[model samples]
Target: MSFRARTTAVLAAVTALALGGAFAAVLVAFNGLQQRQLDASLLAVARTEAVEVHQHALRFSDRPGPAANDIGPLTKFGIIYEDSGTVIAATYPFERTPPHLADIRHPNAQPFNFLFEREHMRGVFMPIPQHANTFLFLATSREDFEGDKEYLFRAMLAAVVVAVGWASLIAYWMSGRLTRDHRNIAAVARGVARGDLTARTDVSSPDPEIVQLGSDMNDMVERLAELVSSQQRFIAHAAHELRSPLTALYGELQQALRKERDAAAYRQAIQQALEATRRLKLLANDLLTLARTKQDAGESPEAITLERMVEDARKLVADLATSREVALDIRLPKATVSHRHGDVTRLFRNLLENAIMHSPSGGVVRVESEHHGSMLHTWIIDQGPGIDEEDQERIFEPFFRAPNAAKTRDGSGLGLGIAREIARGYGGDVQLDTSSRAPGARFLVVLPAS
Candidate 1:
């Protein structure tokens, strides 16, 4: 069966068991109480008559039951008998023959149940204190309270039926409320499977556990959507970036073959094609570096100071700086860090090349550093045009380039993105210094120092 159906069935079963036990106990107790009351009524009348018989008053009522429907201490039959069970004075006339009495071993003055004249009756047999072998058997008809017992049984059965149905309904409703969050989560998962990345399970509940479960489910979906979106966006941009150079190289070869060309013209076409091929190779390497920075194990970690890492990166980009006639001003800090060697070096080198590429041919690109608590803060400030205000926030996104920023002959827009990812991998971050006054685009690099 389904969960809700099972839950409701179980609740109903438990309710029936509980109410059955309780009502049965009540019925038993009520019967005992009625019998005890009947016995008390019979005992009082018997003792009073025994006193009368001892004094020889011997009074008897004409008739009490079927005439009065006796509900109190009124007995319909009071018989005084001799020891041999013969010649007893009865309170009322018998319509037919009276029932034969059983011989009790001892007369302890306890009440006993019997039948009299086809009706249920209770009697108490007691021997008179002074009289030898003489006894009193006081009996009362129990027919009046039979109707009460029947009524009580019918009432209890009805209550059990109502209680089980009502309790089961309430339990089913509560179970549905509890599992609503689960249903919502399932819906979101199905939507995601159908490629609806924006689907979310925004659910609430009075139960704390359910609330937490819903929150966790929403968080998981959000993370999955983000990863999927990033992958899609990355593939789209990489395709666009790769298409430009690949098309250019293909066009160069196609044009060179379309007609008979001179040797110098052919050489020029080949050189242009080779340059496009080199750009494609550089773009591929940058994409690979971007991918590797996500996993720190791609390169081994080592102990290196901030100044030493920055100087190593500067050496790799020094040839570019010389070719562009831009001066490099380096001032390094003594702060040390422990991370993957190549990832750290590439982080700084990406930033330095980005600066050098944007700076004018003769402009200065300064690599400056300082210590901020346990972090090593480095700034690569350039003299080129600063980034557009609209593009400042987006520059570090994969393959994003500012519209107004200068582009060199060989460049991929993933430099800033790769640099930021590597820094963040080592518990550091790279950000543009938007508030800087003196220069073009000023970028800040912060890393934890060991």
Candidate 2:
């Protein structure tokens, strides 16, 4: 069955069961209360008859006349008898067996139910106060009591039917209202699946479960939209960056093919083409590195020593440092970090490459480390001209370059961003440390250490 239909059915069934149980309980309590009231009335009638009864001719009135307040035969009936089974006064006619009078002790009479002349009756055995060895038997028909009870039972049965039906109807309505929120969320999700990024759930509900779910789903869609936008921007930037080198390479080859030139001229064209190809290669590698850095490295952790990692990364950029006449100053402590060897090395290499490229000839690029609780901080300081304040903020953006970047060196501009992404993967971060007291820009990398 569909979820909404099942919800409606279950809600209706629960409401029916609850209302039915409540009505049944009420009926039982009301019946008991009504029976108690009938018994009280019967006992009250017996008490009045006792006070009016007399010994002369075994009658109720001493004046030898019909009593002023004697109950009729239909409403009440009884017989007075001696302990030896002799009759005293017959208050009502009997068409069946006389009331079985138990020799009850005075002041301790108990009431009972019995059938006489096919009529349901309530009776009591009473002992006379003044007359020794004398007693009275009393009974009353249950006509009014039965009639009221039958009426009440019929009324209660009708109430139960109406209450359960209405309760079920209300329950079905409420279930539909609740499930409507889920339906709206599903609709929004379907729209999102079809690439409609602006779709959102418009759910408003009092239920806490629905409130939290709708809030979370909307938040998820919002985050998804942001990610999609970021990915599109990333793709656009990557294509733009790739096109420059590709166009240069294509133009160099086309120029070389257009004319019959000397061997030297052809070699120069080939060299220019190779340089463009080299740039394109570097861009491809940097793009791949950035992509991989954001992914989970599904490998077991290795204990990488800080000093060794720094030297390994330095070796990758050793040729560039040598060509620029830059000296490396390493002062790393014996700290070990729990990370994949390749990931940390690549991260360090990217940062080192960025620093080495920007350093002045014969300048020193210092690599240092410090410990703070469980975290290790590594700083790479260079003796290069400090970045422009505006450029400093955006230097890590992919394919971005400083205004004078081409004068000093050629770069992909993804090095710092990739470095930051790698550090973030291992519960760490890399940032430009503007607060450092160093002359050149200082970059700080913070990572957890074992």
Candidate 3:
């Protein structure tokens, strides 16, 4: 699900939980308060009835018609009396006249309060002080108690319903605001992915986290756009550079082959054509290697022994060095240094070939390998005219030939660029070291040890 929907769902669930807990607590507290009030009212009624009975007991001998005055204004009271037995009475007479005062007498009769019927009622029984053979019973019906409780229950239920409705509305409003921000972020991300790197999310909230997220996303888009533009420019420049050499080679060959020529002229033309073909092949290979290195940089690395790779590179370039009359000096440590083999080898071959190609006749080209900590370092130093300090940094850029080297030989100048790309692919890098003690260029390759 989308982030906005998920966030809304989580918020809604939390709101429901909070509302349920609050509503239940309110209901419980309301019911408890009502019950306490009902008990207090019942106790007040019982006390009033007890006082009336006590007064009537004091006048028992003086009264003529009945033991008590016409049941007092507290007439809704249900009553029971016990002398020889039990008798029930009420202000309002019943058709059966209730049991007389002989049915409930017992040795264990005691005064107590209890609830009776659906209505909560309180009952009390006490012996008359002056009337030796009489006891008075009084009870108050809880109809008022029930009526108040019913009203309270209805009020509480209405409040809960209203509270829930309000909570839902608030939740909806908050979730809508959150969802809108989430949608804006998602839309911006989608646009960026579709190559619209200028797209950015609107930051409406003053929340720090959201504002930071928007800033970070915009920064990432800007960086991506720059990288894409740089890559396009590089590709266009590389194509132009390659086309120039190919066009020159094609024109030279066509012109050389157009007329009948002496053997020496034909031989020279063929040699020039072969040199052009070599340059083209070298350019194509460097470009392909650079592309492959970039792709492989994002892949899982494999183990390769530095010593073995250096040995292989030396063997591959041995013939070229011999043909050029350049002396090869290979020095590898006895212990095995492991790394990403393919990239390491590519870096080694490029640096070695660059040194050999640039070195003057009879010049020595040295290849050395060593290990330090978690890194493998390789150095290729040629005893040719060394690069200037200012040009060392830019030497690895594609098609960037140093002034002296360009004058000395027709070098394509992509070898160092391709070498550095491979070096970087293996979590390593290559750079020209102008501080070399010898009077030639020193290219250092540092790779992560496996």
Candidate 4:
């Protein structure tokens, strides 16, 4: 069943059962109470008859006469018996049984109640106080009691039916209202799946958990939209950047093969073509590294020593440093960080490469590490002219080159961007430290220590 229907049915069933139980109890209690009150009235009537019988006996010279004169018999049968177990008078022409007389004469006999074994009859025996061995026996038909009980049963059943019907209606209404927000969320998700990124659930509910859930779902959709837009822009920029080198190589090859030339001329053309191809290869490798950095977000962390990582990165850029006549000053301590080894290695290598490329001849590129709380901080400082104020913030953006540094450097601008992306993927980050006390650019990388 639908949720609404099931909810309503469950509520109705519970209500019906509860009400039915209560009604049954009430009916039983009422029947008992009514029967007790009827017995009381019967006993009272019997007592009044015995008193009148005593008065009549006194008037008739100590011999009992008719016990009741004007009052009609309310019981089906009424009898007045003497101390010798003789029936003096009776409303109905019925003989008293032997057991009835024995019960009256019993020593411990008080007011007595019994059901006749052979017949559907119940009666009470009330003893007379001022008359010796005198007793009154009275019984009413059981049909009256049964009729009243049936009437109560029918009335209670009707009330239960009405109550359950009303309860079911209210439960259905309330359940539908409660699930309306869920329906709205589903509609929004369907719209999103159909490429409508702008669709959103604007529902507000009184339930705090539901409200929080809706908020989280909306936030997820918004993040997905942002990611999709970013991927599109990235693709466009990658194509434009990649085409530049490919076009230059294509033009050089066409010119070189247009006519016959000397061996030296052909050798120069091949060299130019090789340079273009080399640049293209570097760009392709950087793009792949960037993609991998994004894809390896949940890689398990391994124990890697920060000192060793920095040393390895320094060696990778050793050739460039030597060519620039730069000095690599490394002062690292024995600190270990918990991160994927490949990600940390790539991040550190890119940072060192950026430092080496920016440093002038005879300049010193310093690599240092420090332990700060749970984080290991590595600072790469170059003694070249520090970054200009305008390019410090945007330098870490992918494919973004500093206008001043771009003029002299022949490297792709994706090194720092890839480094930061990898650092962030491992729950750490790399940032350009603008507050460097030295006369060079300082990049700080922070990673969790094991």
lDDT for model 1, please.
Answer: 0.80
Task: Please write out the lDDT profile of model 1 over residues 82-160, one tens digit for every residue.
Answer: 7776645666644245444454323657877776557787677787776777777667777766777898999999999
The order of the candidates by lDDT, greatest first, is 1, 2, 4, 3
Q: Kindly report which residue stretches of model 4 are placed more than 4 angstroms away from their true locations once superposed.
A: 28-154, 176-208, 254-265, 291-311, 318-345, 356-365, 382-397, 401-413, 421-427, 435-440, 448-450
C-alpha lDDT score of every prediction, in listed order? 0.80, 0.77, 0.67, 0.76
Give all TM-scores, in the order shown. 0.80, 0.62, 0.54, 0.62
lDDT accuracy of residue 347 in candidate 1: 87
Clashes (candidate 1): 0
Model number with the top TM-score: 1
TM-score of 4: 0.62
Q: Return the top candidate by lDDT.
A: 1
Model 1 alpha-carbon drift over 4 Å, by segment: 1-30, 50-75, 78-95, 103-107, 115-118, 128-136, 156-194, 200-224, 248-273, 406-409
**Residue by residue across 117-166, what tens digits does model 2's lDDT show?**
68887676776666777776766676666676688778877876787677
- After the best TM-score superposition of candidate 2, give how far the Cα of residue 259 lies from its true spot, in angstroms: 2.5
Pairs clashing in candidate 2? none
| lDDT of each residue in 1-450, candidate 4, tens digit only | 887788899999999999999999999999888666656665565556556666666211222222221233334556667767777666532444534566534333233444454444445576666777677665555545557779999999999999999999899999899988988888889999998989888778998888888898899899999888777867877887888888989988999999999999999989988998999999899988888887855458788788777777777888988988889999989998887776787788888788888888888889888988988888999987788888777787677777768765767668888998888877789998987577889999988788
Q: Is candidate 3 or candidate 4 better by lDDT?
A: 4
Model 3, stretches more than 4 Å misplaced?
A: 1-188, 196-230, 249-275, 291-346, 356-364, 369-376, 383-394, 402-412, 421-429, 434-440, 447-450
